[model samples]
Structure formats: C-alpha cells, structure tokens
Target: MKFLYILGLIVLLSFVIIYYQFNPEVYSFFPECPFHKYLHLDCPGCGSQRAIHALLHLNLQKAMGYNLLLVFSLPILALQLFCKIYSYFTKKTLLLHFWYSPNTPKIIFVIVMIFWIARNLPYPPFNYLAA
Candidate 1:
C-alpha cells in the first residue's frame, strides 16, 4: 500500500511538473477564474495557475508576484499533506493535528475573506495585491 501510494504521488507530481513547465499562462485551455470574469474582481484564486507555473519553473519571486497568498500557504499545505501521508503509511500520527481545532477553520476562513477583499480593493498598495 505504501509503495502504491508513493508511486501514485510520484506520477501525479511528475504530470503536474510537466504541465506547469509548459506554462499555463500561455495555454488557452486553462480555465480563467469565473469570479473575475463575471464580477470583474480578483478572487482569492485569481493568479493561482500562473503562480503554479512560475513555481514549477523555480521562480519564487515570480510565483509570489502572481499570488502571494498561495506562495505563503504552500509550505503549510505541504506540511499538512506530508503529515497525512506519513500517518497513512506508518499507522501513526506525526504532526499534532492542530487543523482539527475548531478555531483553526474560523481563523483560516477570516484570513481568506480578508485576503479576498484586500486584493479586490482598488487602491495603491491594495491594487498591487491583485493579480
């Protein structure tokens, strides 16, 4: 099971690396954010595709420029993913499951909402936040 899980993860990562290496920004097939299209506002996910593309190419600054929130969140998300996969394979928890705390979700939601609103604000520093 562990071997299968690792194999699956490797394959998935390989595909993602290859796809993003091609640069989703230039790819017409990559779907544009519906929220931005309809509302003319930058959603929380506006530049995620370009961010991922820049990340895959090892351009950290470019990735952050595309989506600063996503760049900052990747490490936390990766740690959570590592903890989950580690527990699954070893049948023992690794990281303390702080994500299960009731306040965590609320805090995360508030942060996301703030980021969403801040990015959409049409002002100097706030405008720079938009993709």
Candidate 2:
C-alpha cells in the first residue's frame, strides 16, 4: 500500500511538472484570492506554482523571486518523503521529532499568522522576500 501511494505521488508530481512546463500561462482556473486582489498584497502561496515551474527549468533566481518560502520547503518535504520511504522499505518506524509538540492546530495557526504578517511588511529586503 505504501509503495503504491509513493508510486502514485511520483506519477502525480511528474504530471504536474509536465503540465506546468507545457502550459505555464494557463493556471487561471485557480481563482484569485479576494483579499490579495483587492489589497494588492501577496498571499504566502501566491507564486508557488511559478516557483515550481522555475525550479523545473533550473532557474533559481526566477524561483526565488516567485516564492522563497516554497523553494526552501522543497528540501524539508524531500527529507520527509525520504524518511517515509526508508521506513516503509526497512520496516522500522522512524521517529520525527519537533522542538514544539506535534499539535496540528497550533502549528497551522502559527504558520498562517506568520505568513500573513510577513507578507504585509514593507521593509526593503524582507518585502522582496514575499511571493
């Protein structure tokens, strides 16, 4: 089952990369967030697709311009996926530790608040950090 899940995910990721490469300009099915549109502010995930697209093309500068956070997240996600695969194959559960307890709701709340506040700042370098 785990193997199947990972295989399916690989297929899905492959399809997304292909789609983004061939049809970069056709993502309008994703509706604009009203707050971002009205306020002319970026949401944390605003340029994630573009970042991924740039990453696929090996354009680091363009990816960073799109969303530095999303680009940074790729490594963490890769690590997590690797751990999952390793455990699945070895039949040994690997413990994932966090500085904070693994409380989903608290983590999500903190993440959202941080993103909301971080993207709103007008500081020169930090402002450019937003998506």
Candidate 3:
C-alpha cells in the first residue's frame, strides 16, 4: 500500500509538472475531454486541464474562467487529502469518512449534476460556465 501510494504521488506530481510547464490549450499531447468531444457540450471537468495550468501559474481569474467548480472545490479536496494522509499514517482509518457522510455523496452528486446541466445551458449566466 505504501509503495502504491508513492507511485500514485509520483504520477500525480508528474502530471502537475506537465500542466505547469505546458499550456493545455496550445498543447496537442494533453488529453481532451471526451465528454465534450462526443456530446458537443462542456462537462463538469471539461476545462480542468486548462484550469490546472492557469492555477499553477497563479492566474485566479483565468483558472476560474476555465473551471469555477474545480477552483471552488480545491479546499475541500485538500482537506480530504489531508485526512487520508493522516489516516494512512495512523493505520486506524475510515477510508471514505472525510469526504462522505452518508448524505454527502447524494448532495455532491446533485450539485455536480446540476453544474453539468447548467454549464450546458445557452443562456446568459449559464453560457458563462462553458469552457
């Protein structure tokens, strides 16, 4: 488990470095969102790559423009990551406790679904969500 965790960390760091160094918009090697390609609409994570790039460069406006959802959720994700690391070190853990509270999954699901749908809407504020 420790080895796997280290491997995962390395892979994640590699991706972060890559995102930091390359502009996803101008790079052909970066993976495109298949959901947008197939459905012709922005999904919840459509601009996450570009957002990461912008974030790595400390461009908050551009990052939020790319993916507001991702920017807004980073703190929660960081907290969950911290909880996981804490649990892993202690060896007494609830695997999903930090991010889940029975109703949490349902609530998150609803929110993401709503964002996914709203981002596709062609109206004023909704269209702003498109990446």
With a 3 Å backbone cut-off (N, CA, C), the pairs that clash in candidate 2 are none
- Please tell me which predicted candidate would have the highest lDDT against the true structure: 3
- TM-score of every candidate: 0.86, 0.73, 0.88
Off by over 4 Å in 2: 2-7, 23-31, 103-112
In candidate 1, the residue pairs with backbone N, CA or C atoms under 3 Å apart (3 or more residues apart, or in different chains) clash, namely none
lDDT of each candidate versus the true structure: 0.87, 0.75, 0.89
**How many backbone clashes are present in model 2?**
0
Q: Candidate 2, residues 27-119: lDDT per residue as tens digits?
A: 675446677789888877777777777888888999998788788768867787778878978999764555236685597578767876787
Q: Between candidates 1 and 2, which one is better according to TM-score?
A: 1
lDDT string, candidate 1, 102-122, tens digits: 899899899899999999899
Name the lDDT value of residue 46 in candidate 3: 90
lDDT for model 2? 0.75
Which residue runs does candidate 3 get wrong by more than 4 Å?
Answer: 90-98
Per-candidate total of colliding backbone pairs: 0, 0, 0
lDDT score, candidate 2, position 109: 71
Worst 10 residues of 3 by lDDT: 92-101
**lDDT minimum window of 10 residues, candidate 2:** 93-102
